[model samples]
Each structure stands twice: as C-alpha cells, then as structure tokens.
Target: MIYTELYITEEPSEAMNYHHEVRQVQSASKKKILHETPIRSQDIFKTLPDQQRPIRVVLTYGVAGVGKTFLVQKFTLDWAEGLENQDISAVILLSFRELNLVRNQQYSLLELLIFFHPTLHRVTAEKLIVCKLLFILDGLDESRFLLDFTNSKLVSDVTQKSTISELLSNLIEGNLLPSALIWITSRPAAVHQIAPTCLDRMTEVRGFTDAQKEEYFRRRFRNKELSSRIISHLKTSRSLYIMCGIPVYCWITATVLEHMLTTEESAELPKTLTDMYSHFLLVQTKKKQKYHEGQEMRRIELTRTDREVLLKLGRLAFEHLQKKNILFYQEDLEQCGLDVTEASVYSGVCTEIFKRESVIFQKPVYCFVHLSIQEFLAAIYMFHCYTNRKTEVLQEFFTEDDKGNKISLEDISSLEDFLSRAVEEYLLIPNSHLELFVRFLNGLSMKSNQRLLGGLLGQTESSPEIIQRVINKLKVISCQGKCPDRCINILHCLLENNDLSVLQEMQDFLKSDNKSETELSGIQCSALAYILQMSEEVLDELDLAKYKTSEDGRWRLVPAIVNFRKARLHDVFVFGGSIGSLAIALTANPSHLTELHLSSVSLGEYAEDLFTHLGHPNCRLETLRSVN
Candidate 1:
C-alpha cells in the first residue's frame, strides 16, 4: 500500500461550520474554502483539540470532485502500511456505488463484509466483536437504497441476517457494531440521510487551500515559467480561480493551458469557464485521434463522426445530470444511442480518457471523471438542442407529462430566461445542483466559445444586442428576488457573458462622492458582495442601508458582512431561504465583525440560531444591538 498526503482541512463538527464550508449546494466561493482550519488526514478519527468526546461514526462530506474518495484511500493505505491508527486492527472499506448492486439482496452483516472483502470470510461474528474495526462506506449519495434510519429493524448481532439498508442503519446507529468506528463519506446533499444524533462528528473536506492550488500547477509542469503564466492567467478571471479550488478543475485548466502555451497558441488561451471546457473537450479528442489512432494531427477539427459520438455522450451527460446521478449503467448509454464498446475510442475528455473521465467500475456502473466535466458535456448537448430547435426535447423538459419523457429548455426567450427557467421551472429541483450547468449553458453563448464549438453548436447568433438583452433579463430576475442560489448563479451568468459593466459600475459607485444619488441594482449588489468577499483589504464598515438599492439588493449584500469589522443591518431583514448566508458570515473564522447592529430588524424563526452564534467558537462579535 502506497500513500501520499494532501493539504486539506477538517471543518468543525458544528452544523454552522458545515453550512459555511459548503455554502451552497455546489460549494462556497474559493475565498471561503481557504478560510477553513487545516487538519491532517490521520487525525480525522481523533478528537479535535477543542473536543472532549472520542470520535466515532464520523460523517465527512464535501462537494463532487473535492477528493473525498482520494483522502479515504490515502487514510486506508496509511493504515494498511502500519503508519497510522495502530490501535485499529483492521479496516473494511466499501463504496456505496458497489453496495447499490446488492441493494435487493439480503445478507447478514458478516456476509456483507465477506462479500466485499473476501479475506473476512474466515472471521466469525465473535472475532468481529473483538477486532477494532473501522468501516469506511464511501459515496452515500450514489446509493440507490432507501436509508431509513428510524424504522429499520435493528440487529445487535453481526451474524443476524437482514436487508442491506437495515444492516447499514443498525451498524451506523451503533446497534450492530457498537465497538466499531464507522466512517461514512458522502456529498453534502446526502448527509441528511443520517440524522444529527446518529453521528459523533461531522467534518467537511473543503477542497484545496490556496497554496495547494499553486503546488498542483507547479508540480504538473516541469517548466517554471509555464506554471507561473498558468497561475497568473487563472488569477485574471475570478470564475476560473474560484473553480480551481477543486483538484479536477485545476487538472482541466492545466490540460487546456499546457497545450495552448506549448503549441505557441498563447494568444488563443481560454479565459471563461465555457471556453476552457470546450477547448478541453476538443483538445482531448484531438490527442486521442493522434496518439491512440496513430493519425497525424495538423488541424483541430470535429469530424461528423466525432460530432455524433461526442453529442451522444453529451446527451447522456445532460439526462443523467438532471437526476443528479453521477453513475450510469449500460442501459443509460444505449438509450442515448451510444455504443458501449465504441465509447472507449475518445478517451481524452470522456468515455475512456485515461479511464478516468468515463469510469467503469467493477460492475456496469459508469461515470464522468468529475461532476463538472459531466456538466460541461451536458451543456453542449442542451445548446445543441437549442441550435437545432429540438422542440420535442424542449417540451419534455418544460413540463412533466405522465409519460416520463424528459426534455430540454423551452421558449428560448433571452438565454438567461431560458436558463433561469431551467433552474426555477422544476420547482422541486435544488437550484445549486443546476448552477454549473446553467453557467456552462450561458458560457456557450460567448462568441469565443461558439467559435471553438462552432461545429457542434452550428454557428448560433452572437450579437452584442443579444447579449445585452440576456444581461438585462438576468438583472430583472435578480431584482425579483430569486433564491440566493439562483441569484448568485445569475451573477455568474453575467460573468460568463463577459458582462463586467455591472462590476465596474459598482466600483464607480463605491468611489463616488455623492453615493446616495447613485442607485445600485440587485445584480450590482451581488457583484459588490463578490468583490468584498474576494478583496484583500477588509472594509471597516458594511452598512447595507447606506447603499441605495432595493430589498433584493440588500439581501444580496448580507453575504459580505463577514468581510467587514462593523456591520450595520438596522431595519434590515434576511429572506427565509437566504438567511443561511448570514449565518455563514457570522460564523466565518478569522472573523472581522466586532459589532453588529440589527436595530428594529427581525430574524423571526431564524432568531434562535442567529443569537446562539454569540457563544460559537468562531463568532467574534463583541457588541450586538437589536430591538424586537
């Protein structure tokens, strides 16, 4: 067993910490990911410096591609090599994706362990009781079983036979393996499957810190100058830098940048997220054709077969993305007109790229190398639908028919409205889940990106007037007070369109003498919040009322309060759904806030949690003034 360490942090067990660590469903901005506390991987099972209880049944979660599985692998390998956690006699690692295969089968806890780990076949139930076992169940989000923690039949004995869910429930709840240490890994959305009372500690894997992000690029390229240029260019685009916190995004960026710079195509380097992913797709395809097929590469071109094959994969990406299902089956591939065996050809971007992007597990389960790559491909397919006018597909997506046929975007008003409805139309949809997809969809509208994917997208209209209309529609939606997830994504959409006018306008308003005369829009408030959160210079004061803006604008600025020393939110109120961002601000580590004035403001249902922050470990508020 070989192992290597990664620079990472284990967030505090408090729900507030998890809330801030994973601010939205996708992830908090890169600024917040860097603000967390760093804890080594081996120390995850040990109690924190501030804690008293022995850590057991740890629920560690992070967003997709944040490297939760990699950390688990490293921890297990280190244990096997006798370098860490010597007290534990054995480690049993299982993935929920593998567990999904046997979801319908019944087995005793002992049999389950033996099935996954054949060496455990000789171990009896009595032996299990004596061994210090650490059961690491990975990828709870990918599990297909209904994890009913409340009513599942509890089995105290490891030999007792039961359904997989029941056995899992009892083991996780400490009924079956009371002496065993349980470690469950999941995406943040699925952590709710285990109630708060069922776990001892909750730690979030908050991706790479700033230094590690730089370390990744430097390690990738032998040339120091190339690495420096890559880092410098990433810093120029806030969106790219923020996304680079994820290791997978960093790799994708490196792949795109290395090829462009080395090929003397530095002038054609990608700046936006859409541009990067598009070039990534084409570049990977070009490499596979040249190296794997023994073809001479002279020009970057998407042949008709290449277009058909990539779109099939893209369609698969889009359909499954709607369900938030990362793993797929053979049937899923065939349904999209994709040939299973033929998919291995274009292994660079997907299907078989180093067997990383399109992964086939021990079973028939398949998935993209990363969630964002799946999203990028999905966006391409959806954009193809728009360009080709696939009404039947769009109709299926716009409404739910009894037939269960899913579709794509409809009406195709301004792409923002179309994209806006993509998030809001499905009321049951979690807005954050669709953010990356929508961002990619909007990014595809860029002229530069369109040129790159022109073959697939087929030369869509890219006029400045068309872009302004989309930008204006986004502002109207932001002002109408959409959910913070959707609103922030709207601002991201503007950034994807290269619409920096609002950001510049906010900067001008901030520097103006008669600021009271200048009124900021909701989108501008969002831009302001983003700037303040990412700024190196902390503001001495953040008084929302002083800014001339609508109620939605005020709501958008609440997230930036953590970046200021004194916050005056007098007569202000946070919307119910948006209040979580405020909670995050108050509890952010290295807190700058010393005084918070909420005079005449009402937190209402959230008042209890907000007030409880006064004693939280990260809360540094010294003065709090509020009426009613």
Candidate 2:
C-alpha cells in the first residue's frame, strides 16, 4: 500500500479553518450528482490500495485555478522524494496540452513514454512495463485533438505505432500494461470524454478550505501582521473571500496586496474581480523597472517594448477569447503581429503573466498564464483600439456591416458606443467573456490605472468627458433593459471612474415608477454590492413586492444586503423570497441595516432569526416598522 501525505504546508489541525463544505458527489453514490459534502483534500488517498480490485484509474476534476495542477505537482514531487507511493517505480507525467502535438503522430506506448520521459529511452519496453508505473495525465481539456475513442484503432503492443488517442484509450482500458496505474486530471467540461466505466474512482479539487486560505496567506507574506490585515480585509467582502477558493485568485490577491501594502500607493485595495485583475496587470508592468536602477531610463525603454508586446498579446488574447480558444499555436502569435523571436522575448520578460509551452511533435503554443488574464488583456485591447480609432475600431472589429452603408454615424459619435455594442451583442448572453472584459475597460479608466497605462503607451487616451458619457449611457440602458449583470458592470465601470453622478443616476433609476418592480438577478446583486460599497446614501430601498424573484435571486442579493446601512422595504418581500439570505446577510454584518422598515410585512417562520439579529448589540437598527 502506497500513501501520499498532503503536507498541507503546515500542521494538519492548523489548516482546518472551521468546517468548510466541499461541493462534490459522494464517493459511495454511484450516480453522478454533486452536493455539498465535508471532505478534506488530504484524506482523499487515506484508504489502502485494495488487493483484489484496486482502483487503478483515478479521475480528478476541478474548475480552472482550483489547484488541480498544483495537487498533481505536489504528488509527483512527494513521490520523487521517496516520501510516498514507493510501490510505484516511476511516475510518468504528461500534459495533454503538450500531448496535443503528438495526436497525429504514431508512437508506441514505449516511445510515447520515452518522448515525454527521455531518460527511459534506453530501457527495454519489457523491463519498463514489468515495473510498477503511474501515469499522471494533466489538462485533458487542453488537448487540441478530440479523444475520439470510437474511431481510434486500438493496439496493445508497447512498441506498436498508433494514433495518440488510440494509445491513450488502450492504456486507460487496460489493453496495454493492465497492471499499470493511471491518474487523470481535467476541467469539468472534458470529464465526460472518458467513459464512466473507465474511472475506478473520481474526486474533485474543491480549492482552499478557509483554514487553507489562512495558511496560504501566512505562507505567502513574510510579515504576519500584513498577512492578517489582508485576510481581514478579504473576509469583509464575501465575493472576494469566495474567489480565494481558487488558488490562482489567492496568488493574484497576494501579489496585488503585497505590492500595494509595501508601496503605500493607495489605501484602497481592489475589492472586485475586475479591480484585482487590473491591479495584477499594472503590477506586471511595474516589475520591469526593477531591472533598471534609474527610473527615467526604465520608463522610456520599458514602455516602448512593453507596449508593443502587450498590444500584440492583447490582440491575440482578445481574438482567442472571442473564439473560446485559450490555447494557441505559433501562427496565432504571427496573426497578432508577434513573431517567434519577439514572442519568446515577451514570454521570458512576462513569465509571471505569460507562458510558452512546447508541445511534443508540434510547434510550441503560447497563452496568458490564466484565462482570466487573457480576458483582461482582451478588454485592454478593445479599450486601446477604441481610444486610438474611436468608431473605426468598432466598425472594423465588432460589426460585420458594410463600411459604405454607415448604418448609425450619429450613434457611433457617443464615447460609450463601444459599451452599448458590447452589452447588446455579447454581455447579455450567459457566461459571456465580455462580462469581465467590459469590467476591465472600466477599471482602466481610473487615474492611477491610467498612470500605469500612460507609462506603458506613452499616455492614457481616455478623458473624463468620455467616461461621463459612457456612464450616462450605461445608466440609461441598465434602467431600460433586463440584464442585471450588464447593469452591474456599468456600475462597476462608473465606480472605477470614481464618478458620483452614476450613484445619483442609480438612485433615480431605482426611484422611477417604471423600474420600481424589477427583480434583481444574481449579477445585479453583485453590481449593487459594488455600488453600495461606495455610496453615502443607500439607493432608495428596493420595493420588489411586485417583482418576480426566484430563491436564487434572493441569495444573490445577500452581498448587496450586507452593505446596507438602512433599508426600508414596503412588504414582507425578502422573507417571502429567501429567508436564508436575509438572515445570513443581517447576521454577517450587524450594522447592515440600522433602520429596517418592513411595513405591512409578514415575518412567518423567519421571525425568530430576524428578531435575534435585530436584538444583537452590534446592530444599529433604531427604527422597525410593520404597519399592516
């Protein structure tokens, strides 16, 4: 029996941050239905390897940035050090992202092994297969070629030539080296490509537990005091804290906060995903200065080269994201005006932000370190394009309408024309990449952000007049339309601009008779949370009694509700919707609503908890009304 200790980077108990609920399917439940279950990532391999029918093929799935690769890396490192899985003589690790190169190339199992693990080239196939081997295949979703099992010609010989898919299918199906073990990692989307029958055991990476998040912060920052402060600040915003579940987001946070904390640049830290990502980009840009001691020299030479590379990468990122392509080949770089030499230089200089990976038997591919970063860069590209050419870029890049026709010249003159087009054409759809891109566009307008971009591009191109026009258009559109997330992004953009007029516009929109009975979507709730954070006056209390709100919608409002200083509801609306969110929001933040008016409202079963929160000493509620 072989076992791998999680190490946890600290004492086991110390890593336990209360009881964190992991959302996954129970191992005992044969059906694939995911539910919240309390399970530790460390305890995954605790059970012994069964002698009779050992679980040889394990499939672990997770969302991007949830630490799947990190877990695999840790496991491999531990095994190599002889601390765990000693029964396995060798661990052959391969990334499908890299394996994509050899998809068409014929190779025997022995050749494929040696191709990735060149040290085994001299070892005879018979001797290698006889020894215990564990194959860890990572990033199955990154495979360029479809793993078409139905069409693949399967072969069992270790030295026989076959398609990569055929070899992989045969290996997993026990057609070749039946005794060998396999471990596969994939994002959730690609998990179904492998037949259910092939998986001996399935596990999902749930990212950092609360305790693990704390432990990570402690390990990341040398100053314990700063780490504690960062943690405390992050905990205050539910959305920010939730994002920390992704290890990469946590790293981004640490990177941004660490720099901000040390520089004394600004007291306010990024609270939203857009702000955080914008800060990340700025941090990367500033990093080049360290190489040059004189600030003047760094400023001049840095921007010229950095700007060119960024523009090219941003173009590539934007185009790829539009096509839902995260991975790219050499031609993609050239298409974006980057040659191999320039791209390589950029990759080395921006290693923290960009990555270049060699695909065996194929040309190397390039991509931003994270998908979110690509989206951010894409957004930046859109903004830069807009700044340089105004309506021309939108006409060329966004619309397919003929240039001679000139459909709406008057509409194109408005500074926010790009925002309008993005919302109407893209962001209204579910899971739109433009959602984040638009937010990045907003964040880029900030003066401090402008300074960073100005340093890069020689000068920031946007003006306050243009930003004000965009905000005005956003407010008008958000009020008239049904897309809450778009409305929120508009608000987020306004916030980045630091314009208070949008707050009044929002207040006006909420107060409008026509807009009074609108239900807030989850995205709208998030948007409201951003708005409420910066507001001195609460947006006229939402009277959603006439609105159609689902249970999920109420939960979405929790983040927004917790930001309220005083809320006056006209009916038992929130309770009738989702009592859980109401209770959680109020309990989470005692001073949330100091003067809550539930006029003609019925408490029903939620009365006890609602009253309990109101009675808490920290609560500042001085007025409570229920006039039926």
Candidate 3:
C-alpha cells in the first residue's frame, strides 16, 4: 500500500521526499499541472519529418543514484506538453527493469512491441509504426538480458554489442518495428564497449552543478532559517558536498536533516563521507531495531559472511562515491568477492526488507538506487574490516615467507587448504575477502622484503593466480609511467632470484612500443642493470634511441638513471661501466638533467671524471651521487 501510493506521485519534490520513507502521494495530475509545469517550456523539442527513415538514437549514461531516470521523466513529461501540436503519435517510457520480469525467452523486437500492447490489432500496430513514437529506454546497463545470474556471467555470448544495438537492428533490418527516436540511459561501464554505430550521439549526465545544488536545496527547504542552516552544514561538510554532485545525495542528506529535526537531535552533522554514511547506517540500524527488537531484527541477524559481503560492497562504494557511479557487473562484483550464481550480496540484503517502501532501482546486472546507500554500506564495512584481528590475519597471510623448500606439493596444498575453501565459501556467500586479499597482495608487493613477495607469488590458488594473471596482463600493455610503482619492487625480486624466464618476459614487455613505454623502460632499466652484470651482450640488443627525447627536444633520463643507479653495487664495476655508458649518453645533449645517479656504481678514476663533467650547470646535472 505504501509503495503503491508513492509510485503514483506527480510532484517531483513530494514524490522523492517521502516516496521511500512513507510512500505517500501528495498531488494528482491536474493539481500537479496547475501547481507547477511538469515539463519545462524552454526544453528542446526537435521533430523528425518521417518515421520510415532510421531515427537517430542518443544515449546518456551515468551511475545509479544520479537522478538519471528522474531527468528522463521530467524531460519526457515536459516535451509531450511542449510538442502537443506536433505530429508525435505517442511517447513510450520503458524501463529495462520492468521488461525483465515479463521476459522469459529471447523474444524479438517485434514480439516485445506487440507484447507490451496486447489490445492493439496487427493493422493498428503497423499504423502506429509509421507514426513517430519516441522510445525512451531507461537503464540499458541494468538490463537483465545481459546478465547471467544463474551462471555468474556479465557479458552476453551473442557478441552483437549491446541490447540496444540488437533491438535497433531487429527493428530496422527486420522491418518489424517503426523507425523511432530512441533515447537511452545507462551506467558508463555498461555502454563502454558498445559500438559507436549503435547510437547517434552519446552524452554523459554529470552530477548537479553548484547552482543546481543550491536550487535543489532551496526547493527542498521552504523555511529560510532551515535553508540557511542546511546550506551552512553542506558548505562545512566538504566530503558530503562532493558526494552531493549526484542529486540523490542531496535527497539523502535532506532526509537525514529532516529526521534529525523531528527527533529534536542537534547532534553534530557528519563532515566526511565516512562519517555521513556511518550516521546513515547507524540510523538504519536503530530504525530496524525499533520494529524487530533485539535478536529477531534482520539487521542484527545478518551472518558474518553476509556482513563481510556488505562491508566489501561498501568499501567499493566509498572509493567511487564522489563520482556518483554505480551499475557495475558481476566481474566488478568479483573484485569485491561477491561473484556468485545467486543474487548479488547487496540485492539479497534488500530482499530482507521487501515489505518496506524502499525505492530500489534494480536491473539484473547492476543494483542500488542511490549512491548514498552504497557509501553508507561501504563505510560500515571498512570500519569493521580494518579491525586489529582482521589486520593481523591479513598481515600473516601476505607477509609470511615461504622459502622454496623441498616440501611435497601435497603438503603445500594441505597447508593452503583454507585458500580454495575460502574462495569457494566466498563464491557461495559473497564477501569482501577477495578484495582484501588483492589489496593485501598489492601492499605486500610494495614491501622491500623478498620473503613476502615469494609467499604471494608461490600460491597456486585461483585468487593468487588472478594476481599473477593481472601482472601478466599488465606486462602486455604499453607502460605510460603510470604502471604501479610497486611493480618495480616485484621486478627487483625476480632479478634477485636470477629468474631469467621472468626477466625475459619483462624484456619482451618493454619491447612493445605501445602506451606503456615509459613504465617498461623503467622496469627494463632495473632488470637490464642486473642482467648486464651477468651478460653485457643483452645491452647490445636493446634499442635505447626511442625513449631518449620528449616532444620538446629535452632528454628524459629519469627511468634509465633511477633503475640503473638503484641496482648498482659497490664491488660491481662491470655493471657500473655498462650503466655509465647509458647515463653518459642521456646527460650529453640534455641541458635539464637535475638528478644524477651513480649510487650503486663502483666508480673508478675515469668514471669520477665523467661524474664531474656531468655535474656541471652547463651539463645540467644538479644532484650527483656515486657510492664508490
């Protein structure tokens, strides 16, 4: 009953305010029109001449909780009134979420068109096709058709691009449907791989501008006193304001303020995103407690695994909260340890409060109605997961050394018995342990200890394998100097172990003349310095001329110098000699070389003279260091 009333609201402010909390409709269509124009008069309304020609489709996409659907609704309602005299036949607003419930089989576009209107005869449908019907497809990224819930797959095997493309193709090529102007909305990731031909124009719906935020705040709070207070609160709350780029965050913040005023609680308002969400979650918990009471409460009754899953989801939400982006797929969920055959971990939690009038925006592939809820959940998760016990457990698993002893594979397997089981359990229940595992491995790779590196790389489990696979995948790409700084440490580990296979693989990675060149150069310089000690012939095979010059004719020697100097040893003169040649070449023509590194070089009298020449202002070397 609560949800039914809320679903019928016409006033934007009233509908959004109490829709989720109380679900009460305040105005009818007639009253809403008289009170305020449902559609803005100044909005653009361009008419197409014919319905037979292929109509241009433009799509706008962003994250969930960013007021995308609301914007579309507002635009359509306004457009219909503004273009009342135009020959527009009808405007159909179809949500992918609604369509998913009725879709059991792979129905064609014609079948879907007919299915939505069973009363219309075939002749009427044909005539309607000739008339210009504006088709607004909302939430393409959330389309259930693209999701494999039963199999934990995100992308469809058909490889026809997006559902919109397939639908458009059916209508245009098959001649089953009319050439209608199609406007779509989806999250960024959903439409990322979609081909350019699918849509005529693609615009991104950015978060509310500051002016829009001010307008929204004024619209929500009629009382000048309350409005001023709220504005002050928002201004002081930097993180909350950043989160407010999405309009839904504004609504959530208003809701919190409204509740605070009603309860006569003038408690300190949250200043940061973490604090804001923490407050929201605490409020949610308190509200749940009032209804269920103690042990029987659904919030309190959540399993440890369930709680962990929620926390992981929360952490992800917190990280991307400022961007107001949601609508991620199973692969995205997998990164957080929630990849499984069952409904997503967050959706499952939503299911527990099914009777509540919560405005849940669901699509099969992605979930979450508001960015605030995601942030709230993420903040709670981070708070608990970073506790001392979990930290220690993560530290031991990632930091402990596993020397390459002659232990049997079976014994090693038994020792790591928890890994497969943990992964399996996480797969079934959906938790943040996998994300924690990845973060831990990432952190460990940054450490100077070879033992920690060996421990992480020695693992045979799927989780650890993913880490290696990621590294291997990264190796193939062009390094844009943006490759993780921690990767240098890993390369150092491989060099110290004399792992020629990894060294060769790294060398092959550096040879690719793609976007990752600068990164590969640094890795190469480090690996090659060590390799040169064993065989200077490898240096003869490298082509160093490519990375020598920037676009402005200035020489860039940071990558080469850093790696070469870091690997230098006091007694290793051969390594120093080979590096000196590369450094000398880098410093020769460049007049801006500020940092010079002969750090690990066992410099002879000749190398010292070379260092002095390189240190000159005309030579452009500012800080020069020679170990010996």
Candidate 4:
C-alpha cells in the first residue's frame, strides 16, 4: 500500500530526475494495481513488530532489476502510512553505493546515520541501537571494494589478514550496542561471506511472474489496434518476454514495438534483444529528422559498420557505468581496435542520427539520458565482444610462464597495460568506457594477491602517496569507498616500522584538500589502531578508543566486527606473544591497550579460557578478536 519514495542516485540532481519520473508514474496510476498474488513478504514484515523475536536483521536477495528495492520501499511506506502511533520511530532506506564516498572513514557510520536522521541525538542513536530503527541497506555488491580488517600495520614482518565473515560475527556477538531491524539486499555474489547466523530470513526477487508479464504486455497494447502480424511476432518471442520480466527491458521492448507499429514497419520487427535495441536506436534517430529528405539522407549515409562502432562504444560505456567509473580515457577506444579516425566518423553519424535524443560529453563521449539505453547497449556488447578474432588478440597480449604454463608476470603486466590503454581510448568516446573501466578496476582491486595494488602504486615509496593514488583511482571508478580495511592494509606494506612521520603524513593528508580525505582518514585510523593493538608498546601512548566514537556516539565498527570474525589466520600470533599474556596485559592496564587485534591468534585452542577471561564481568578490553 506504501511505496518508499527514496530514489537512489549519485547527486541531488540525479535524485530529482528519478523523483520526477516516479511522480509521473504515480500520477498515471489512479488506483493500486490488483494484488495478483498473496503478499509473500507479509509474514516477514510482521516479524519486525514482534518485540519478543526482536528482528534485528533481515536479508533479501534478488536478481538485478527484479524490484527488490521496490517491494521493500512499498512495504516500509505502507507500514509508515498505516501507523496510528509514532512508536515506529523512523524508516531509513540507504543505497550502499551512495554511501561509498565515506567508506573506510572513522565517521562513516555516523555520517550515514546523520544523513538519514539529521535530528537524531547521541542519546537517541544509542537507544536506537537495540531495535528502535528500521534500516534498509540496498545494493551491497555495488560497494567499490571488499575489505579485510584483521591485519596489523605496526609490525613490518608479517601480513595482517581479515575477512567480511569475521567482521559480521563480531558485530552480532559483541552485543556492544542495541540492535535495529536491518534489511540488506544484494546480488548473490555480494553475500558470499555473510554469516549464516546474522541472517533471520532470505527472500529472492524472481522478477515478474508469467502472469504479471502478460498483464504488463496487455496493458501496453489494450487501446492500440494491433496488427495480426505483430501479435504473431510477439507470441513467438519467448526469449524477449523472459528478458522483459525486468521492467526496464520491458520498457525498451515496448518502445521498440510502438515505433515499429507507428511507422508501419511490422516487417522490420527485431527478433533478438540486440536487434530490438538497434532498431529502437535507429527509429529514435529517425524521429529527430526535421524532414523526410534529411532523415532519408542520414539513414542512407549511416552504414552497418557505423552502427557497429556506436553500439560497441555504448557497450563500453555501459560497463563503465556498472563499474562506477566517471572518467573516460582515449586508450580504451584503441584497445577495442577501433581507430579513432573511424570512430570519429561514427560519432558524427550518431550526432546527426540521435541529435538531442542523447547527451554527448565535451570530448565526444556519448551518453544516453536513460540508463536503460546503456543497459541495452551492454546486452548487445555481451553478445558480440568475444569472437574468435578477439580471442586471438587476448592471447597475443599475454605470454605463458615457464612454471605450469601459467600467465607470466610479464603477461599480467601486459594485460594491465592493455586494459589501461583500452580504458583511455574508451574515455575519449565521451562517457564510453567510463563505467566498464571502473568495473574492471573493481575486479582488479578485488583480486586476492594484492598484485593489482602493487601495479597501480608502481614504485612510489611514500605510503601516503600510494594510498592517495589508490583512493583517487577508485574514486575515478566511482567505487562506494566503503572498504577502508584494504587501503589500510596496503598502507601497512609501505609503513612497516610504525613510523611516526608516516602517521603524521597520514594525519596531514586527512586535513588536506582531497576528495577522499574522510575515507582515507578512517583507513589510516583503523590501520593505526591495528598497529597499536599489535604492538603493545605503541598502544600505551595514544587513546585508541576515542577514535572509535563519533560525535553522534553510534558505534563505528559494527560492520568491521562482522568482517574480523570471518577471517582465517595461519601461523598467526596476537601481540607478539601468547593470547593469555596479551589479554592479561590489556586487561591489567586499559590505557596500554590502545590497539588490540587478536585475529587469527589460534584462539580456538583456548577459546573457553580466552572468552572466560575477555568476557569477564570486569574486563576492561575495548577491542579484541579471535579471528579476522
């Protein structure tokens, strides 16, 4: 009965754009659509009100574009509107992608809380900790980076290890704050590390059912006189219907059909998704013609080759959008083996064809006003980017290693160079490869080996500089910037000795005029905290607990705790000594335990004793983990 009206976007302007479109839809629908199926989520929604169960966490997963967000919004809005009492304090809907800018920052959680509840006080924040708020976090996979937080930076000798699973464990187990009814939505790959214990229920968004899809199609054609020829074509298009289960794809298909029908061109109906989109773009271009002569002349001049180039560029741009890359590069185009000179001719054709239908970046990057168009372009690319010829090109870009015939370092370096070049060229096409390149960067960063970071940083000796470069590159890719732990670990490699000067540099950088200062500062602080905890010596000088608290007073490390608990440690030692010694020292004098990370400390062998001691009624330890 209620539709949550939160429109997720990068900026306020974008949000306004989505808001306007949604408003138009609302105005068109005078009555609610009939409830075709029983509300499957009602039972789940009801549990949120059960004080005894105290439903603090719920996870909903669905295929992309299946309307998971829509359902969640609808449920939350309905609940809010129906409330007779104000006991349901607030309903906050957050898109993880939008919060990425503050990722890995000390006050990120605080920033998010304030962004949603500007009037919330420190006391209210604490009270809400136990289940007073309904927080819906959508699109976890959209986050820019995956972080591991159990590692230490103070010591130069061994690497620190952490995982997302560990972090979730700590949050639920620590019971440091009151829990809230939290809902998370993600694609399957995003929740691989989610602890089973943290989840109360899981729902999959299966897109529109067959009946819904039929109803949707019927609604579009109810008033229009349909030709038997088109109806027959539609009846045969099973794959098209399946794809159209997603609303955006349905819109694209409908637009294509409408154009074909108006032009009396039923014979030209597309048989495949790519052809459908191609036809759509071509028709869209023709609609802008001032006269028949101009339209005919332009259509005659634009060859299939030109269309291919435009479609390829569109696909690359779509990838960039997916990766959240905002910057386009010239080399990205070249990597596709598309000559700039030829691409320029195609660009000219697209300009004449689409006219005001699309927006062209200053440097020739063509961007569709609707993201659906980009999605259409990407679908086309996936169908064609890999061919026998392209496969050969990839092979030529790499050399086999002598050991096990694996890809050599030289080959990896070459691939990176090739990707970089491709990214540069794609950028020149005006918003072309920006999104695709960003996705590439995200995939590269998510690699387990850290080789990508090393390559990106090059030989830079300055740890802060390296971190800054990584952050800057990530921003270019439009990553959510939520994973500070990875950046902190990278910093550890460069700052082996707990160098005070490096710490000072990090502090100075945080204060400087950088876009990612907040996120970098968070990463630096976490790294510092990790180091201090690892080396009992440094923990004595600084107050680590202060950094853990934001001005708003909400806990900053809930997510971090979840991550620390899911990590695996091999031959790992905590505090350079046995777990008992470290615990005794930390509990004996709290000030001396500024940083306390015991992740992967073989704690299972002494779990009962450690928990008995660390979990004691009078324990003074602020932070300690058995696995990261």
TM-score of 1: 0.86
Compared with the true structure, what per-residue lDDT tens digits does model 4 show for residues 371-413? 4455544533432332212444334323342233644333333
What lDDT would each prediction earn against the true structure? Answer: 0.71, 0.61, 0.41, 0.40
lDDT of 1: 0.71
TM-score of 3: 0.45
For model 2, the superposed segments whose C-alpha errors exceed 4 Å read 1-53, 122-131, 265-267, 290-302, 342-344, 347-349, 357-365, 390-397, 400-412, 428-431, 455-469, 475-628
How many residue pairs in model 1 have overlapping backbones? 4
Question: How do the predictions measure up, each by TM-score?
Answer: 0.86, 0.67, 0.45, 0.44
**Model 4 CA deviation exceeding 4 Å by range:** 1-43, 47-54, 83-87, 116-124, 147-177, 227-232, 293-628
Candidate 2: 10-residue stretch with minimal lDDT:
10-19
Per-residue lDDT of 1-628 in model 2, one digit per residue for the tens?
A: 1111122110011101110111111111111122223333333334443435666787777666777778787778778898777788888888887787667788888888888877887889879778988888888867777665566676878999888888888888888888888888876556768876777666766566667778889987789999998999898765567667667778899998887777744457776666677667767667655544423211123456667887778888888877667788877888878877754445534768878776665467777777778887887777777666645546655553223244454554445776655655553343334655666666676555665455442234367777777666665543222323224455555555565564555465556787546655543544544455435444445443444454334333333544465564544334321223355335332235556656665566657667766554335567776677
With candidate 3 superimposed using the best TM-score fit, by how many Å does residue 271's alpha carbon deviate from the native?
A: 1.5
Q: What TM-score number comes out for model 4?
A: 0.44
Best by TM-score: 1
Against the true structure, what is every candidate's RMSD? Answer: 4.6, 11.3, 19.0, 22.8
True-vs-predicted CA distance for residue 47, candidate 4, Å: 4.2
Residues 1-628 of candidate 3 have per-residue lDDT tens digits of 0000111111111111111110010011101121112222112233234324343566665545555676676666656787442555666666775665554554444455555655443635347656777677788755656532233323222222234434544332223343566666776445633444444544445456566667777888788777677777887743355556566667767766655554535465655433344344444444533443322211133445645555667555644432334455556567766654545354444432111221223323555555335534543343233322344423322332223233222321221232322222222221121322222222222212112112212223234454454344323322222212122233432322222465675466546666234443434444443333223121222223334323111111222332221321222232222223334333322222454444344445446556455543235444555554
lDDT of 1 by residue, 573-602 (tens): 654422355665666555678888886676
Ranking by TM-score: 1, 2, 3, 4
